[model samples]
Target chain A: MNIRPLGDRVVIKKLEAQEKTKSGIVLPTQAKEQPQMAEVVAVGPGGLVEGKEVKMEVEVGNKVIFAKYAGTEVKYDGIEYTILKQNDILAIVE
Target chain B: MNIRPLGDRVVIKKLEAQEKTKSGIVLPTQAKEQPQMAEVVAVGPGGLVEGKEVKMEVEVGNKVIFAKYAGTEVKYDGIEYTILKQNDILAIVE
Candidate 1:
């Protein structure tokens, strides 16, 4: 991974969706929603916006939760990833 | 109008959707998608997360573009607004 996102953007590896319930019942493909959790892979250096300098909050390897339907999906080497701005991240998962 | 969002959260007033299309065609109600543009009303101070302090890039009154279906909707004083984290904002419209 030799890529850096431009200004306020982030690169993330989306976590795989769960396929089973609490009772261990396998769910159908349509029964699960798109995964909203991911691992931060790379981050962009914050830049100027309206004369204010921004800073990044997340770091590489942080597990994060992001907005559903946010970010663009990018496929590299047959692995899927997402790229979005830092603002789309809701929280860092512990 | 006295709402202050907590930590990395933002308050935005959604821009109304256009009712007509190009060439003077009137779009029906069901044909319009939810608005993804907004005016920033308030911003939260970036906070400590994983030993890093995030910084806010956007200010009040900025026209911003965000992901559709990203934020939580709220109605106050008969006006609709959205509350989302900074990561949900894609760009600031100049």
Candidate 2:
């Protein structure tokens, strides 16, 4: 199933959070940092907002970083995804 | 003192929460919805992100709605402000 985003929103597939620390000790779910990396799956049309034109920056295949706890999380077809505005995207990963 | 947002970041002054509901019954702080309306005080320069030019949509002095729990709160110079990226803003109100 497709989760088409509206406006400047985009659908992203989150990267798995690290289960362990750098020291190789396993950490509990609540103790680990929330996952921030994601792969952009779909992008919505970004246009004029408040008399200013807002442009879309990331492409569908780009890997990006999102603000922690930014958007609604949903599970679709057994895959977890997040729908967020493009502004929630912090950075693009090469 | 100035809170100059950097890299598409913005400084906003949150609007006061309504103490009473539409039904005219006064509500306590915990019973009210989180305050989301904000006035844009300062805006960061919208620039290239991930090799694409990301233009800013809202201008200074515009009233906007932000996602719940989207920014870092601070009390500066006797006033409260929230520092968040442009994406955290949900809409601009006329």
Candidate 3:
């Protein structure tokens, strides 16, 4: 990707929603909601945001869990992605 | 009135929705949505919030405009109020 996010924003690729449950029951796509987990694709520089100094916490390629309905969806080169503030990310998934 | 907000949170009383439009037409209360304007009832002492330095901007009795659906609604002593971060406030009305 040739794009770089600015100031506390992060670019992420959403992980695919689970298709099967623990009991091995396959679920229809509509039955599942958008996944909360994602892989960090790009990281913005840690700096001031809205008069507040924000330090970027997550790194590129890290798996993360983010708040629901927190990011803007975008499609680039047919690949869907999300752009959200660092604050919207709740935790890094091991 | 005994509540004191912490961090950058502010306590506010929502203004009543307009009963009539400028065209001299009276509208039912149900036809109007929650008002975006509010009177500042109490202000939090701003310092550091979520690892960021925040400065208190609004004062008590200041009429301000805030983002729609931004605050938590609370009922205290039969008076309704909203508690939200100062960042949710859009502008101070004259």
Candidate 4:
């Protein structure tokens, strides 16, 4: 299934978090939380500011760090996706 | 208490959620979660994009609606605050 964001919102696919510690210790499911890292897959054209269109700074394929609890979660094609506004993005990893 | 945001981060104080319905019906505590509304109190000077500084679009006193789960929670002077990037802000209430 294809999903498109509305306005300045972006669709992201989260990166899986490590299940084991660096010391090779495995963590239980209840002990781990959803990951905060994601890859930008789709983005809105831009948002309106005072009736003028403002383009987004981040683009598709950017790896971003977002807040753990941000965005609305949705499932498409058996994959989990997140829809978040551009402002919800914190930083783009180089 | 005084708090300063780092980089393009902004600090917001959450608006209280209505405990009772408009019809005067009250919801139970377990049914209620933290409010998603907030007012911008402090903002970072700006963030660097491609070596250029960009100013924030929203200003202090702007009431905004953020995602149900966004921002890092912090406490200062016995008050709770959320620290989020400028992009996390969805819209400014007029």
Fnat values, candidates in order: 0.00, 0.00, 0.04, 0.00
In model 4, pairs of residues that clash are A69-B69, A70-B69, A87-B87, A87-B88, A88-B87, A88-B88
Distance from true location, Cα of B61 in model 3, Å: 0.6
What are the clashing pairs of model 3?
Answer: none
Error of 2 at B41 (Å): 0.4
| Candidate 3, chain B, TM-score (2 decimals) | 0.80
Q: What is the DockQ of each candidate?
A: 0.03, 0.03, 0.03, 0.04
Worst 10 residues of 1 chain A by lDDT: A19-28
Tens-place lDDT per residue, model 4, B1-94, is 2454545778788876562233243324453443366788887667553234668888898877676456666444456667787778887866
Better of 2 and 3 by lDDT: 3
State every prediction's TM-score relative to the real structure: 0.46, 0.45, 0.45, 0.45
Question: What is the two-chain DockQ of model 1?
Answer: 0.03
Tens-place lDDT digits, model 3, residues A5-79 = 555778798776562233243334453343377789888675655566789989999978776567555444556
For model 2, report DockQ: 0.03
Which CAPRI tier for candidate 1? incorrect
Residues A1-94, model 2: lDDT tens digits: 2444545877788765562232243324463444367789888678843334669999998978777576655444457666687888988877
Superposed by TM-score, candidate 2 places the C-alpha of residue A80 at a distance from the truth, in angstroms, of 27
Q: For residues B1-94, what per-residue lDDT tens digits would candidate 3 score against the true structure?
A: 7889999899999776451222122222231232266789999997878878777767998866555578899999999999999877644544
Shift in Å, residue A65, candidate 4 = 0.9
Chain A TM-score relative to the true structure, per candidate = 0.76, 0.75, 0.79, 0.73
Top candidate by lDDT: 3
DockQ of 3: 0.03
> Where does candidate 2 clash, by residue pair?
A87-B87
